[model samples]
Target: MTLLRDLPLSALRALAAAARTGGLTRAAEELGVTPGAVGHQLRQLEDRLGVKLVRREGNGIVLTRIAEAALPDIDRGFDALASGLRRLRFERRADTFTIAADPSFSSLWLAPRLGNVRAALGKLDVRIVVSIALDSMLEEGIDLAISYRYSSARDLASADLFTERVIPACAPTLIRNRSDRDGVEMLDRLPLLHIDQTMGDDVYPTWANWFTAAGRKRKNIDHGPRFPLTVLAAQAAVSGMGALLASELVLRQHLDSGQLVEIARDVPALTIKRRLVWPVDGPKARRASAVAMALAAVARAEADGLRSAVS
Candidate 1:
């Protein structure tokens, strides 16, 4: 049997219209076509279906038995299609906002604070599109994007959301005695969980970079189980699999809950700036600006709290 999608939609519409209006002339008037076009469409429909759908009865037309049986379902399908299109139009209105972010940022940071965003926005519908690819922001309908790179797109407005410090952290049990050895020496001896550096930029820090930043150099910095995402490396650190060079912002909850502890405090930390980007002008620009302000406020408060805890 042929799929519904394989059937010609125009022919189906012609059949439905001809049956509804009870004549080729009236169907053509409804469809804005000549009566000859309507008749041709009906013939095409019949040929495709391999069945007679209508018959000439004097000056008017009569639906065949099969056509009468199928007309009601076809009419209902068209009604449903119209309703779906209406819903899409309603959702595309300015009241709804879309934010795109990488998976690590979305899950570890932004997802937790979405409630505060909702409370600030009141009735607006907020949508999140999780992705590492910032290029999607250029597509229509995406109102905002949170990413590590500062986009140079002329049509976009961008600002720093926060600069997160990367510190060495591990499960509390991983370090038995802190005072016996040098901090850099101790960290060098521990298994270090590595995040796959797929960003193809120096923005993402590695164990080798961390060691260098700490005023020391170590060999075999690449040894360890590798994870594609920061959150997974963090979990590995929590499980005492190894020490993780983690973003202080993403690891805030884990540190607070005692799942992980900051190590090598005397060493320099790596900083990565997270940016918020949105269209400079659009139907949703005003609302996107409102959301950007709200997000920055929440991020600042959280950063302050993190600093206080560390202090």
Candidate 2:
């Protein structure tokens, strides 16, 4: 950019605000300066540019034809400059917290609870990056992360938000025909829904694990349609596709909305832990601490209500 340090930034700001507000007093209110100061800046700007910029009109002031022609560009330039400065300020400080999480968790759980977090944090800005690729948390400058698997990074701080019990879930209509008490036994007979995303990771406990936990011996545990995401798998199960082993905490909304129901509430629930992770050694780690506190508040507020809903 060409150096225009000779043009006073304060004068340009006053001119743009006056143009936008259509009056000196309103511009002064926005700029936190007096109308006389604004008028003086406008005069100085006009003198520097060697042009008449404003004229007295009745009891008010109006932009001259030359100033009117320049108003649009000046407004655009000053607005862009202010915006760039705001971004830089956010970047330098800890006002904005960047978060990363699994899409399913982000959509089903964390996104819904962000309102509470926002309320707790008050003035903090949150940027959410949803992806299954969470190993890059440190590289991405993620202040906080919600992940299905536990973190093994020695340099990162981790907190267990909550553990979810996995249960057989399906559309209520799917099991409505079988009113018998041993409906969970039918889970083996139906086409079991398997989330294919966890096939490669092997960290998330799968259908086989759930069956073992439920004390059933099914050899064909891998026989089900595959989906790339858990959210998709849960939706498919809700559509009466097949029974899916889903998280009790994650499936609360589906259970509450009657989209899906657990096959056996008393049976042993498969347990899975969700965690919050962030680098231990970052300048913005303090903000991460604040976020963690907010998350804890959210968890405390929801834990009893969620667990009691079906316990």
Candidate 3:
């Protein structure tokens, strides 16, 4: 007999809501229960499972590492359950497909290039959930997702979206003498753009990493004004504020439009992976197949263009 089968789902729901909202009060508000009631259910879940899923940090509750590992699965399960409820409640169209992606990725990359897919699939209702939270899509029944995670749960299917080749890029006007001197040599003269945070995480690439990759290791590698998102950093680079070391895949459209120019095309740097993932079959699985095809088509175009730009 499975031990998980004996677990009360209401307690699980309370725990998932708390994990999602990051607080008991908000989780109670969301679940239509009192804060104390939510806390009670959470304690019940912990006791039943014999694990401390959360710990108090000041007035707010924070997930333990074990909870962090389990929350994604719980979120995904609740998302599918909600989708099933929605399907039962209302009539839906066969052509509609919902996709979830980070706000920065949606704004910088997909928003500009999605027209191609829309034009190709004129019969589909494409819904985009611009969220930094990876679980938002899963919880809301999105058909597909683009995430920067290196890997995911074993049950879902995923494919590589594009090559994440990190290179230095800036506006055309910023590099007047880039041809006169080596691009790597111009690094000390031009400002560097730093991205201190990306999406939900505070960790991202920096000017120091790029310089060390190029064998420079300058002492003053941390010399640029920091931005919160890669999109903002890329835009600052395009505005001539500084050169940004970002993924060539994300910067391909800007590079193609001549809004941004690669400063260190010959330098090889770190690779950041992004993936497109979907379930094998669900309520919206058929439409998801089409959306996946559309995404794969776009991915090919992007990869090909980046190759041409680099070579």
Candidate 4:
């Protein structure tokens, strides 16, 4: 309860340590200082306060009633100060931002474009967690949630990123090297890599959907090496494991590189729009807005590229 505004932080730290450890020697060892230095600090503090903070006891220092009562508050102040310093260091290091997205979008879409975003927003740390269930942006610590949905919940804000269109694609080798093979015939030689979402009991775009859209149904749509994510299925196709139903967003690079070639032009799958959702308030909302702007720019460019390709 004494005024000690002009006291040095080091002296305050030393007093806090001696009080906690019950002796100057132990406190000095813990603080990597000599016992005499700690003792000097305690004496200086007592002189400043005009009180006897420590009393001589058998082989140890005993705190006076005033020191005992005040030490806990002093300790708490120092702890709070240390915590604030740590937080300041983290904030100075970089602003942290986290996005919640589906695995397919993360691996196939956002992951590829993250470098551009990083370049645009320097000294910003970004993380992505994949899950199908919609997360409350405030509750789950998400800055943004990208989902294939019509609208965000009433409590959340939203932006429509872009729509998804798919095409049947296979390794270029399959078509270039096996020119004699037809769609049905090629199935026997090359695997029909099916994305096995049955385990999770989720409805996902399948080879059957593509075939049916083309007015041709392959009875063996369910056959081949199965993967949980569409991105994995696309990779399998890239590796020549089999053909996959590739979303336009996921396979843009492969199609451009001639790594994956469209098997049929007639089968255009149903389009699905990706929406960005975020909470109305907090640090996360600000981060989400910045990220959404960058992402929207990317989506626009992609759409333009697709338009050129289609034209």
- Number of the top TM-score candidate: 1
lDDT of 4 by residue, 11-89 (tens): 7788778777878899999899999999898888788778988887888888899988988888888889888987785
Clashing pairs in 2: 166-270
Candidate 3's residue-wise lDDT over 54-138, tens digit each?
8988888999999899989888887998889887633454456667777677777777777777754467777777544444445
Give the alpha carbon lDDT tens digit for every residue of 2-98 in model 2.
4385668999888878877878998999999999999999999887789998877766678889988988888888788878987776575466677
**Could you tell me the lDDT of residue 151 within candidate 1?**
73
Report the alpha-carbon TM-score of model 4 versus the true structure: 0.57
Distance from true position, residue 208, model 4, in Å? Answer: 2.8
Model 3 clashing-pair count:
0
**On a 0 to 100 scale, what is the lDDT of residue 11 in model 4?**
75
> By descending lDDT, how would the candidates be arranged?
1, 2, 3, 4
Cα error, residue 192 of model 1, in Å, equals 1.5
> Candidate 2 overall Cα lDDT vs. reference?
0.76
> What TM-score, computed on C-alpha atoms, does each candidate reach?
0.65, 0.62, 0.58, 0.57
| Better lDDT candidate (2, 4) | 2
Go through the candidates in order and give each one's C-alpha lDDT: 0.81, 0.76, 0.74, 0.72
Candidate 2 global TM-score: 0.62
- Per-residue error for 213 in candidate 2, Å, reads 1.9
Using alpha carbons, what is the TM-score of model 3? 0.58
